[model samples]
Target chain A: MKEISFKNDILPLGDKLYRLALRITCNKQEAEDVVQDTLIKLWEGREKLKEVDNLTVYAMTVCRNQALDHNAKHENKNISLEDSGVDGFDNQHMPDERLIYNQRYEIINELINRMPEKQRTVIQLRDIEGRNYQEISLMMNISLADVKVTLFRARQQLKEQLKKQKNGL
Target chain B: MDYKYIEQLLERYWQCETTLEEEQILHSFFKQHDVPEHLQQYADLFSYESEAAQECLSDDFKQRMLDMVDEEPAVEAKTIKFVSRITPLFKAAAVVAIALTIGNVAERTMQDNSVGDNAGAPSIADTYTRTEDITATIHIIDRNQSESMAKADTVQVDDITRR
Candidate 1:
């Protein structure tokens, strides 16, 4: 309900926003840019946002739309989202354990990445980000029921996939 | 130790009936030292969930954003307020000032050349003298031609006579 300060409010959301955008766009750089653009856009539209509660969720919604729009426009690019620094995990300590950890995590990420866009985003927000169903529904602009349905499908798919590859681990 | 409660929560989790806190308890149980041998398969999912949440924008991202934000406002303000609103006024004033200066200087110079023959620029006297003034000066020079043939003078003779 107050003017959103970029430093106190929007800048701090960069990680959460980036994670959401990364979930939606599946590309780290694109996700990062989406967060940047979302911040700037919120600043530009601060006057309109004065009456809006929960600027972080508002910004997340805006960021998601931007990411979807970006994905749509560059649909032809077809660059593998994994190429956006899939090796971002730190590997200096516990080289052997870290290697194994990275491999399993990479597989996990790959499985998650292969999910449908909506399902993947729902999983990232609800499971990874620990956001509640109501907040995710609001951010995704979908009904609470739809959020549950999407998450259900995503969890089922992830369980089956992880089980199928259990021997390889 | 018994693990029936977590297993039930996991079942409820798959059914999408678990509350956020219950789901979190499931994640916490799986994240521990031992995830129970029978239920180990779900470890990666919840572990990955926790790990992936740690993914974040790069360190410099905040600095870059602040730089961009700070830089944009100063530039926009300058363009809108100074260049658009005030700069043109200064430019027009400058042009008007230069025009007035040139006009005033030229007017005074012309006045001096016309009103004061000897005081004005001597070059303008030859080019812009009236016909009567030229003729009168020529008569004076004719009367003094013999004495002035040497090209010496107490008075300022017209430069043309020496040439």
Candidate 2:
């Protein structure tokens, strides 16, 4: 196995790890701390990391566990309203265009965040991260069938909510 | 202005039947300004998924992590057999598999799309090792915090100690 460099191989996983952490923790500061702890832990175990077949999945597993541990400790099960951190549009877009875009997305974001952890995490990994069922199963430590069921519920919930919102619900 | 393919894909998408590539196609279709009126209701859902992936940390956070890494000491490696670590997860997976029941409609939908059964999780000795490292680090942080309560500059170490 090729050796893993902390800078080239591991540091670049920060965003992916952060997204997973944020999905689980639902707090940006807590999510960042989870990623930091994950990175530090990864770096400390760099030797063992090389022995692992898939470092990305391994790193993610550790991150998921760490974030879960955080939630367990702090009882932060509900997603935070303050940390939605709406994405900004580029300057090229007109003000009206940007406002409409942000509003639509923010509503969708709220709908997603309101979901249960397993459903939302599946959506995060499958929809947001674009991970395959196999990879997601490994990272979440769930069966492939379970992954699909969880994602199915999540997408169906989003569809129902989106349709209602469109009808001015 | 034909959108038959997209409509079919959207149907599959709601059923969790669409592949990742097909899902990306939905996202791209919705990104355009000229989405058909009927499809516009679904646009924000796909668009949000695309944009949510772009969420990330700032460069300032990167710099702080680098500094903390520099300050941290080297970790001692321990030798634990791989089987010992993964045996429990296998049991857990078995339990989850037994407990998991796809609904009749979803199970039928999945029968057509099912590709492969899940093999057991890969060896992850590092996970156990990581748990140990965290426990040890927390112990150190606790000790330092108690001893250095008077010091105003314990903030750096406190960052790592923030579980």
Candidate 3:
């Protein structure tokens, strides 16, 4: 593929890849590293780019695998969510609103992090990344039913966590 | 704003029956400030989802990534080709070195035995024993000097090197 075309077509998926990596690794620097590695791997395999039907899905798979590998390697180390910082949703809000938003974001992010990796990833792909079940299943290399089952569990767990948080649990 | 529709969607959301768009609608609905008293708690969670989705790498990161791609050697394929071509040469060189070393050792051993026979008396042990003793003495002297120097540097003579 032409370098210009590749960059134009493929690089825009970086944001989606970043979100997946962030959700998986739960740290900004590690997520960025994963995305960087994913992009480099994609570039290395650019010769086979034509065979890919959906570049976004392909790129996401690469990013997910790289993030998983990074998580595996650093499994024994404590992952700090502090590196995500109090930005993104912090701007344009009053102090009280910002605090509330941050608390809620933290709670939900933490709840998602608590879920098993497969469940969390499926939730991310289906809910946050807005991918369909078939697409997510394909990207995740799992069956459609497996994707649905995982997403079901993830949403159920998230709901339970949210309810518990509401009850001050 | 009325949240009856949102409340229903929220139920479906928990059941994993909502589509991505419907889920997005819930997030948008909850992002506003007009949720009823009973549903306020769920607002933060949905709004948080919207906000978390927006968390992404900075522009500086994007630029750095692009620069990295740019910095990658465009001749990577050529370099791989070159390495493949020279690999056989390296293997041949390694083999030749090993063969030469073995041949030299064998020739030296044969010459040594012949010389020993001609000389009629000097054993291999005799030839090695003097050098071994000299090395041992030198090592002992070096060790003693180092030990003394270490002790002089420190007021306490601790036997730290306990081998």
Candidate 4:
């Protein structure tokens, strides 16, 4: 691929990469670092671009690996809320609306954070990112059945947790 | 207030039977306000998933990432250049070190062979003979110096008798 085309083609994957990184790392700064590292890796491997059938999936794999590596290194450290650091959402919404959304967002974030890494990652890919099972399985280097089972378990767990939270547990 | 469909989906959700689209439907249905009291408990969970999807890195982050990529080519090029420059020197040093080691070994071996030939002995025997000869030479020098001091004392005694 021409340098310009490579950049144009792969650049659009940033958000998807960011979301995947965020799900895995759960920290905005770490997510950004993962995305940066992923991009650098992709750029380094630009010569092999033609061999890649799905650039997005390849980039996602790289991002996921980077995030997981970061998580491993910082496994024992506490994840401070202030560590998200990057505020991607608009600040212009009405206070009440922001409050409600923020509350919902925090609740969901907490639930996702509580999930096992694999389940959280599978859910993020299957639900939020809308990737098919086969694609997720391929990207994550797992069997399709594994992907489905993980997603299923993740959703089931989320439901149970939500139910308990609703019941004031 | 009609939640019979959501209630059914919720049952399927727990059983892991709901498709992604169906799960999304459940999320959307529960995301709205005024969920019936019976279904309210599940609302927060689905709504949270829906909202969490929007948690993403900012545009500024994307721009910064692109900028970093933009800088990569230059950095890579410089690194390649740096390595290329240093590699020849490393190769030359390696070659010189190998040559010097070989030369030093060859010289030591030649010296050992010459000494062996002069002594008409095996290399190890020659080496021992050389060490023994050095020690004997030092002992003979020490004996000659002591005899010379004794002779000087006798000559002083004769000169005093003549006076």
Worst 10 residues of 2 chain B by lDDT: B72-81
Q: Clash pairs of candidate 4?
A: none
lDDT of 4 by residue, A1-169 (tens): 4442435777778778888888787777777788888877787787787688888888888888888898898876536544442356565664987776666666777777778889989888876777778799988999988987898888888877877787785
Q: TM-score of every model?
A: 0.70, 0.68, 0.66, 0.64
Candidate 1 lDDT by residue in tens digits, B23-134: 8898888789677877888898888888888888887999999877886556456656765787789999999999999999999998876767665546755773689888
Q: For candidate 1 chain A, which ten residues in a row score worst on lDDT? A: A78-87
TM-score values for chain B across all models: 0.44, 0.44, 0.42, 0.43
Give the lDDT of residue A145 in candidate 2: 98
Least accurate 10 contiguous residues by lDDT in model 3 chain B: B154-163
Taking chain A by itself, what TM-score does each prediction score? 0.90, 0.88, 0.87, 0.87
True contacts kept of 1: 0.85
Tens digits of lDDT, candidate 1, A94-162: 589778878878878888888888999999888988889989999999999999999999989987887
Q: What ranking emerges by TM-score with the best candidate at the front?
A: 1, 2, 3, 4
- How badly does each model clash, as a count of residue pairs? 0, 0, 0, 0
Question: What is residue B89's positional error in candidate 3, in angstroms?
Answer: 35
Best by DockQ: 1
CAPRI band for model 2: medium
Error of 1 at B67 (Å): 0.5
List lDDT for all candidates, in order.
0.82, 0.83, 0.79, 0.78
